[model samples]
Target chain A: MTLLAQYALTGVVTGCFLILATIGFSLTRQVEGFLNIAHAEMLGVSAFITWGLNAVAGWPFLPSAAVAVVATAFLGLAIGRVVYDPMRRLGPAVLLITSVGVAYVMAGVMHAIIGTGIRSLDMPLATSYKAFGLRITDYQMVVVALAAATGISLALFLNRTKTGLAIRAMSSNPELAASRGIDVRQTSRATWLIASGLAGLAGVMLALIATLSTDIAFNQILQILAVAILAGLGSLYSVIAAGLIVGIAMDMSVYWIPAGYRPLIAFLVVILALLVRPQGLSGKARS
Target chain B: MNLVQLFLAVVMFGSLFSVLTLSLNLQYARGGMINFGTVAYFAAGAYAYAIVTQEPPSGLDQYLVGLHGPWWAGFLAAGVASMAFAVLTGWPTLRLRGEYLALTTFAFAEMLHSLLVNERRIGNGTVGLANVERPDPGSLGLPDAWAYAGAAFLLMLATALVFRRLLASPYGRAIDAVRDDETAAEAIGKDIARLRFEVFVISAVPIGFAGALYAMITTLVSPDLFTAEVTFFVWIALVLGGERTILGAVLGTMALVGFQELVRAFPFESVRAAEIAAAGEDIVTGILFILILRWQPFEAMVKRRAAA
Candidate 1:
């Protein structure tokens, strides 16, 4: 039972990381109507920036993270303006492949520049407290807390803010939103910034628990993609639930399957979800 | 490497990937099936060949099935095995539409890749199957590389001819109809699902052969060799050359492989220059993919078949 409790706690932390990654991915897909594989690359850039400032330059963590987050938000904006905006005229297939190209470019550049070494921040190890016969670390608690804050805040922002409503409107029907005098270009630009900014924060949080590597960032694309697909691609609220399910399943699968096959959990969930409910848990049935 | 060796490398990769690109053309360009799990089929073939042709595991390396067969047998098994895999995965997943199908396939590929890495019994735990048999071009008194390159080129030519023939047949027209409008094709009493499944299975055959040929050329098989990068490389080539025509597949492979070779051949001495060249290739390909789609430069390349 304690083992079960421990695995569940670990699963929540993993799910939190995924929620941060997939929410942005889901939002971008809602607007662009294609799978942007390059969204994962944003995490790589922000993680690298945080590593550079906190580890290399000896700056403190919070300030360095703030700068990295802001920098990556701009990077997202620039990538939106430069790559996605112009490419929007093309069909989704073209955009999908282009996003893949962008992903490869970012990874290749990182490989050439950083040489595939594992880099991590110099944060102190957190003390663990035993409760209910399961040990939980302070860092784990902090991760869950931060993730909850981000998710709730984002939910509020989308519900309350004009930009958020506009984003929601565009997501439902771009042509309809445009017909109603919603500024498609400006909404899209704002969507890109917000999505990429979320991606930046996710990257930092992931780096805190795991080491920073370009491959790690790239590999997470599959898991995030799985979460997005299982959540029906664009439904933000459903994505949070999907992320937790996937994360927990991935961690708990080790009890039955070998630990090395944890990825198989995500794969199975995605394939099964796609097969049974292509519309997803929250998606409306398309005619 | 000398210029001759470099030239041979280009020809080898070009022909090998030409086979892959053509397979993709049949699936996507002709049949309208978006299969993102291509590398899975490719790797399946390579592993099948490796299992059949390799010597028994020695020292630290332990893997399943070392049948130790002739080169032709291994190659045939590669194609058949990949076809079987496609049939298994395609039957259920083919019901999905557009992005859903693509993501499911992508998930399947990633799952297989992980399995290959973790299951040492199947793939030898990332060390991979090595010392697989290679046909001796030495029997003909020609260089080994020349033999490999010549074999790949012949395979490409044969596959391309077969694809061209298929495209010219009523079967080809049926698929084009399905791709253009599935409901209309169904209205005309064509079995859309079965046709798609057949195309999907048939397309896997060449890719499987390409994977075996890749193993034969490199004389090794590893999970790293069959990454998503290989799939995208084929995609970039097909999209760049134009999708509907056979000429596009060949030309795209040549153009893409040629561009990479050009960058490699240039004497960029600085440390950063090499990195820039590497990253620039992807950036250029990305931009080109976007531009070609946005502008539809070769829209007329797709021949209309009496409105199907």
Candidate 2:
């Protein structure tokens, strides 16, 4: 029973990281009207930036993570302004395919720079805390706390801010949002920054909790897609439920099946969810 | 590498992968479905071919099944296996539209890949199945490389001709009608879902055959070789060729393959240099993909010719 609880605790941490990773991707789908395939590479970008600043440049962890997040936000903004802005009129399919190109470029650049190897930060090793035979690491706790913080902050931002409302309006209907005094360009740009920044934050969590590799970001996309799809693509609040569901399902399955199937479990749960509820946990579907 | 060898390599791989690009064309252009899980079918075919022709498991072999059949029988099984897998995956997911469909298919493919990697009984786990059997071209008094290249070319030609013929027929018109406008097509008595499911299944057969040919050329089957990368590569080719034309699709595959071959042929001084070159290849391919998509020169060319 304790083992199961431990697994569930770990699953919650995994779920938190997944939420951080997927919120940006879901946001991009909502506002930009396309699935940005390159979005996960932004995680790779931020993770590596943090690694480079902390390990290679001998900086402390918090400052390195902060700089990495900010830099990643700006990088995403530039990519949006340069590559995606002109192609906004080309329809979602074209933009989706083009983002694959962007991913290839980003991944290639990382491979050239980092080469191939598993890397870790220069920070202290994770301190494990135990209660009632359940164990959790400091980094894992940070991930959970940060996920809650980001989730609450994002919810507040979306509901309470002027720009946030504009983003929401633009996502639901672009032409109407534009005609109703929303700055289409600014909203789009803001989505990119926030989405990419979120990805950066997730990348930091990933680095803290796991090893880093150039190809690690690619692997995250599968789970992120699973959560996003299970959340019904555009809905934000439902991502919380969907992420925890997928994460717990994947981790808990290890008790019964081999650990190698963890990733497979996430997809299985998603495929089953999709089959039963095509619009996902949310009752709305993206048209 | 020698220029002639490079050309043969390109022709060989280009034709083999063109089979994938052609099927993707049919699915995306005519069927209006974005199948992001194409590698699954290809992997299915390859694994089927490998298992069927492989000798029954002996010492050190962990896989559960090996039919010990002839190459021809295995090749046929490959097609059947691919189509079967497609039916299984497509039946449930086809009702979902657009990116949803894409994601489902992709999820299914990843699931398959994970299974293959984890289940040693499937293909000896990550070690995969090696020493796959193939018919000998030397027995027919032909060079092995040239024979496989010719076979790939013939397969590609057959796929292209059949698709062209299909698209020219009334059935093709119905498929197009569905893509152009679903409601109007349904209003005119077309079974939209059935058409899409059929197209999805039909296009899968050629990919399976291509996968068998790919296994024969390489004489190996592994989870690593069949990844999402192959799916992306085919999509890039489909986009590069302007989506709807057979000739354009073939040309795009050939050009892309030729470019990759050239990059690989260049000599490098060190592992780092080779790594950088490979990365450079990716960057250049990505840049080309972006440029082609941004300008859409191929689409423009087709339009100009139509106007003329």
Candidate 3:
């Protein structure tokens, strides 16, 4: 019983991080109507920036994280303007391929800059508190709290703020929203900035938990996609729920299954979801 | 330089890519399905041939039991395997459009790659298979290069002929109808799912067959050969030549491959320079796709051909 509790606790901790990562993917898809395949690259750039500030410039954690988020957000907006805007002017297929190209370019640049080495941050691991004979880390608890706070704030912003409402309206019908005097382009830029900032925060949290590497960002991106798809593209709540479920499933699978087979489970689940309810759990059915 | 050797190499490389582009064109041009999983079939065929022809001559292999067959049998087996996979994947995924279908297929290809990399019990893992015997030319008493080139050209001719016939057939008309308007095709009594599955299988077969031939020529089969880069290269060929046109696919592949070889032969200052220049081929191809898509070069081609 204690062993199971420990596993569940660990699962919830990792799930919190995944929920943060997936929010950007979910929000971007809702606003842009296209999956940002280069999103993982954005996370990677942020992590690298964090590493640079902490290691090279000898900056402290909070300040470095702030700088990293701002830099990554700007980078994401630039990528949106340069690559995605031109791609949007073209057909959907062209845009999709362009996104793939951007992903490739970003991966290549990251590899070139970082030299494919794995690095770790020097942050202290959060202390653990025993509960019902199970150990739960303070860092884990903080992660959960942070994720919940972000989710609540985002929900409120969407419902209360004019800009957030404009984003939702643009997501539903861009043309109609533009006709109603919403600055569609400005909303898209804001979505890109906020989505990328969230991704940067997720990257910092992920780095603290695991060894930072270039490929880590892409793996997180794939996990984010799985969550967004499982939740149905536009449902923020479902996306968070799906991320938690998948994160727990992945962590639990490591206990019973060989590590080699864990990726197979995710692939199988995504393929099955695609075959059955491609619109996802909360998605509206398209004719 | 002997014109024959250069010509044979060109034809051989051209035929391989032509097979790739043709399969891609079938799905993209005829069915309007953006299949990024073409390499899945190609890898299936190559690995099928490698396993069937060159499995370690020991123990009863359960997962791929009868895989150690002759070259012809291996080719046929690859086609059958790829077609089976296509039928299974395409039936459900064909319902998606544009980016969704592309991402789904791309994910499937990545999964297939992961399986190949991880599943050593059947596939020999990343180390792959090697030293498989090539088809004999000595029995026919011809020069090896000429014989291999001739065989490849013959395969290309046969594929081209079949593709031409299919495009001109009633089945081809149905494929185009589905591509143009899936809802309209369903309204007119066309079974959209069945047609999609059929075209997908047909397209996959050639890709698998080409993979078998590639394995035979290279005398090696590894997972690296079937990466998304390869699929993207085929896309470049299809877009450059003109999607949905068989001749365009053939011409585009030949032009692109020939250009790459020419660039490689140039005396760059360093090997890094050469490698960078080679990577530039992709950049150029991508730019060309954008330009051609915007300009619709095929329309001009149609006008020019009509004038002629």
Candidate 4:
């Protein structure tokens, strides 16, 4: 029972960051209808940026995270403008390929800049709270709370805001939405910024949780994809649920499998989800 | 090694990749299947070959499958193992279309990678299988490089001949029909799913052979040897050389690998030079991929026009 409780705690903590990583991908899928392979780099960008600021430059954590988030938001905006916007005329395949190319560039640029080594966020140690055989750190609690807050606010934004409504309308039917006077360009750019900013925040949180490395993006990318697909790629609420399930599943897999096989759980879930529920938990069936 | 040996090594590596590229070309260019999980079969073949040829580990070195066999038998085992893997995984995954199918394949490849890296009993927990036997050509009075290059070239030629015959056959036409228009092909009674499954499985054979050859040439096999980057490398080569053309695979591998070697040969005397060399190829390839996406080749244009 104690072991299960510990696993559950760790699973929830891991799930918080998984939610953060996948929400952006889900949002983009809803609006853009293509997998942004480059979005995987947004995490690395923010993590490295915050690492540079807090660890290298001796700046405090909040300011570094804020700047990193803004930087990543702009990075997404630039990719949308420079690469995606122009090539979208070609087709989704071209756009998908371009996103992959963008990912390669991001990986190359990260390699060129940092030169490959694990770098941790330079923060003081946090006190832990233990209850019911689970030990939780202050940082881990903060991560979960932040994710909850982000998820709630995102729900509010999508359900209550006029811009969010326009975004959804555009996603569902671009022609009809455009006819109804929704500015496609503005909405897309905003979606990019919001999603990218969320991805950046996830990266910052992840760097705090673990050591930052160039491989972080590559390592997390598959899991992020799995989460995105499991959530049906467009359902924000289901993304949170799917993230938690995958995280818990990964943690619980250690009981039956070796610790190294933890990553395989996500892939298995992905394949199963693709075969059984390609539309995801709450996603509408494809026409 | 001298420049000659270095170039010969490049040639051998190029030939190995040529086989891989041909497989990809056959699948994507001719068969219309976007397989992003090429590493799965390739790694399977390598591990199978290693298992067949390698001696059982005695002390600290332990791994799955250690049965000594002839090199030819190893190659055959590799091909068969790869085909079996394809059959197992492709049944459910082949039902998906376009990006979903590609993503599933990518997932499968990553799963295999994770398994290989994690399961110590499988590939020794990322330490990898080592000391794979390399056939010596000295008995035949041939330089090792020349002999290896000849073998690799011969394998590539055989692959191409088989590929060409398949393309010329009715099966190839059916695959093209599915690629061009799946619904139309189905309407015309082309059994799209079965065709895709067949191509997906058949293409794995050469890739399997390529993987076995790679293990033999390098004399080692590691999880790192079969990353998704290998898929991207082949994809870039195929796109750059023009898909569906006979010499596209060979030309594409030569160009990409040749440029990489040239960058490696740059006169620089620092660790940063090496980094630059590596990153330079990646950044250039990324840019080239973008450019290709913007303005695809004439062959693609023709295909699109015909489809329209």
Best by the DockQ measure: 2
Question: How high a TM-score does candidate 4 get?
Answer: 0.96
Global lDDT of each candidate: 0.85, 0.93, 0.77, 0.85
i-RMS, every candidate?
A: 2.6, 0.7, 3.6, 1.2
DockQ for model 2? 0.84
Candidate 4 stretches greater than 4 Å from native: B1-3, B297-308
Ranking by lDDT: 2, 4, 1, 3
Q: How far is candidate 1 from the true structure (C-alpha RMSD, Å)?
A: 2.6
Question: In terms of TM-score, which candidate is strongest?
Answer: 2
Candidate 3 residue pairs in backbone clash:
B52-B67, B52-B68
TM-score of model 4 (first chain only): 0.97
The CAPRI quality class of candidate 4 comes to medium
lDDT of 1 at B223: 85
Docking class of 2: high
Docking class of 3: acceptable
List A-chain TM-scores for all predictions.
Answer: 0.97, 0.98, 0.94, 0.97
Tens-digit lDDT track of model 4 for B1-308? 36886688678878888998999888887877778898899899999899889887767886857888888889899999899989988898888776777788889999899988988887687899889976678999998778888888888899999999998988788888999989999998988889999999998998888888888888899998899889888878887777787697788787888777777767778887788668767888888887777677746766898999
**A92-210, model 2: which lDDT tens digit per residue?**
88898899999999999999999998999999998999999999988899999999999999999999999899989988888899999999988999999999999999988888888
**Residue B67 deviation, candidate 1, in Å?**
0.9
lDDT of 4 by residue, A1-287 (tens): 77877887788888888999999988887788788888888999999999999999999999999999999999999888888887677766557667878888888888888886778988999788988668999999989999999999988998899889988897788889999999999999999999999999999998889888886898888888888778875578899999998998898777777878777898898788777877777767764
Can you list each candidate's DockQ? 0.51, 0.84, 0.26, 0.71
Ranking by DockQ: 2, 4, 1, 3
